[model samples]
Target: MASIGYFLSCEQFGPKELIDQAKRAEAAGFEKLWISDHFHPWNDEQGQSPFVWGVIGALSEATSLPVTTAVTCPTFRIHPAITAQAAATAACQLDGRFVLGVGSGEALNEHVLADPWPSVGVRLEMLEEAIDVIRLLHRGEEVSHHGTYYEVQDARIYTLPAEPVPIYVSGFGPQATRLAGRIGDGYVTTIPDADLIGVFKESGGADKPVQAGTKVCWDRDAERALDIAHRTWGNQGLPGQLAQTLPRPRDFMDAQALVPRESTARAVACGDDVDAQVAQVRAYLDAGVDEVYVSQMGDDVEGFFAAWDEDVLPALR
Candidate 1:
């Protein structure tokens, strides 16, 4: 059976609320935690974006559950060397229960510093080099490297964990998936596509762990839940590279207008129906995922956890 975890949405809730949710999730039987790393929320409606490293530090003291960044873009917004140091410190704080999940970041976050957002191929190349830099620095040795995409001079993370942190790569498409399989300690994605999992395994990720995340709104009023889902996360329904290229929350607000409410209704599981919630997560586990993390998309955090504790989690287990 796959492990079930809670996804702490830094995009939706503030740091204190996230910490509270982390504790609630642990008490509610979640086996682990997945927290998003973002400089900005996809849209202003989502409303919050805390520095994930600081939240992770509080989480280290708040909950005993393992924590993984659902995805961080170490290539552009921050240098991979700095990311390596932050991740190392987080691992030590979490008592070795940290996973640095990285990806080719979106323009919304990466472009904030005025860097040009490159094409997918170039971004992937940068990600590959960034991963190499991170791994080299994680070795606890003074390292100086002038790579094609990055440079580091005599950098060493003094506050290292007993073991180097595991770096999981996030992939939403075939090329990234192949790269993740070839180099990642594990794979991270949102879709529960079995074919993609097969591609990962065949690309040298055989027997490695696969983690996935999904969103749901657990409410008594299904229509209200759907409304919240559509209003807050309609950007999720946008197809293609719009998510990658859109540089601002207002841009997303405009692009997400193209996404119909019906699409969010289909993409996100809504209502207090335990069966629907279980099925949503089961799809990932059925796809050979080793861990499935669920994020609540409504304001009824207490109700969501209550339902998960009483019904959804039990059924899945």
Candidate 2:
């Protein structure tokens, strides 16, 4: 009974391309959209990183699907106040069809302001504070506060949807999952693991929606698909906090040199095998995920969509 959503990669596509994909996804029966908000692509080869807010505005005009930031970091580079305003406007524009997804964030995007990156513990603390500020602002009141990580003086969001924007928190660990349960309207993660869902629900996230996303490349030639995933996203296979600590795309490129192509092939669902793609979706469903967002990773986006719409999606339904 889980709904399927399309994940639009802002790091890989230009604003127009993303809008176009959003339209195609809607036509193809995708029910919702998850969009990444990043200042930079994981690696240079992925290229384009458009300002996510502007793209959201364009998407408002282009599609009717509900949208969520698959996620955004509101603590650094951009203040929580500004993020609140942006999310409010997006909610208004989309007619209450927008959800704000937030996380502690990676150094790659946050270090742009030249601020010293805090440790993981500090980042999580900052995330909590940022969430507090955003929720307060969404109430449409003049908010003033001085907190451990942020300060606000008479800040108010003038434009907002009738309903306050729902905020979903993203995490990859148990502590963060608990935090999401305590504060988030919903939960988000990339892995399709039921234990994470149990963690979220056990703490306080019970009855709330849980979202998960995965990447796949649909090509007839499996080897070609594997090569594309490795060249552009091999860094994704990095372990531990390497993804969070890596500061630049070049740094990722250098680190990914050590990741074997076989690793990327094993991790990502590649090739035109309909059963394989459907299996990927089933994992999320089996994990009790409320929503599954899938991203097609290579240039075959059109082909991927066509195949999924004609085959995979029907099977899932």
Candidate 3:
């Protein structure tokens, strides 16, 4: 059975607003919650980057639905040791309802510390080493690692969940997908590229869960909604230098400002009808995704929920 989840861009919503939304998602019967983990906002114009960990802690008390980071970069900005500790604390705080979704992050987000961005090959190696560090720490073991990318000195996590936390790797390329299969407890990706699963299996992943999502605005005024989404999130379509790596989400906004409106329109589905939004999500499921997360774009949060709650979700069930 495919579980349906709601996508929350933490950078877009304030802490209080996010908690409120999570509460509403639970009340509306959402089973899972997916939140983007970015260190920076899309641009100075968008203007928000609340710490994801703090927000998740609030969410734990705000709702019962399990939470997953849509994808977090395991390389660069934060060391695997620090991330392992944060994940452990989160798993404990969320009481087994949290999943750590990791990836080999882009240089834009990972290279902001004035450090030279590593090459893709190096990034993959870092990802491999980081995973080892994280998995070992998640096991609540006293970990001592000396690797090409990271080093941990007799580190142990005593506060993690009783069971090891589930680690899902987000991948797009063949090597990364194979790495996911070999190391990840499950796989996470934005699009349902059937080839991704094949890559995972061929690389080593077999019988792992696949989670994906599509974005749409449920608005009678389609153009207005598309305009906002493209203006705010279009950098998501860019292969490099994303909102994460950019100094601010608004930096992305400035960059996105260069793209033609049609480009943003292609990635986002905006419409007044609920069926339209649901169909967009259905297409992802049809692609063999095990979970479909719907990103509610625009300002009509109430309407978005009503449509999905009354029409889309029931039909899926």
Best by TM-score: 1
For candidate 1, the lDDT comes to 0.94
Model 2: residues with Cα > 4 Å off, grouped in runs = none
What does the lDDT read for residue 314 in candidate 2? Answer: 98
lDDT of 3: 0.78
lDDT of each: 0.94, 0.93, 0.78
* Tens digit of per-residue lDDT, candidate 2, span 1-317: 68999999988889989998999999999999999999999999899899999999989999999999989999998999999999999999999999999999999999999989988889999999999999999999999979998989988889989998999999898988999998999999998889989999998999899999889988888889999989988888999999999999999999999999989877888899998889988999999999999998889878988998999999999
Which ranges in model 3 have alpha carbons more than 4 Å from their true place? 239-251
TM-score leaderboard ranking: 1, 2, 3
TM-scores for all candidates: the values are 0.99, 0.98, 0.93
Pairs that clash in candidate 1:
none
Considering summed lDDT, which 10 consecutive residues are worst modelled in model 2? 261-270
Q: Which of the numbered candidates is closest to the native, going by highest lDDT?
A: 1
TM-score of 3: 0.93
Encode model 3's per-residue lDDT on 95-206: one tens digit a residue.
8988899988765566667667666677778888898899888887788898887889988988878778899998877777888888888888887688777788677667
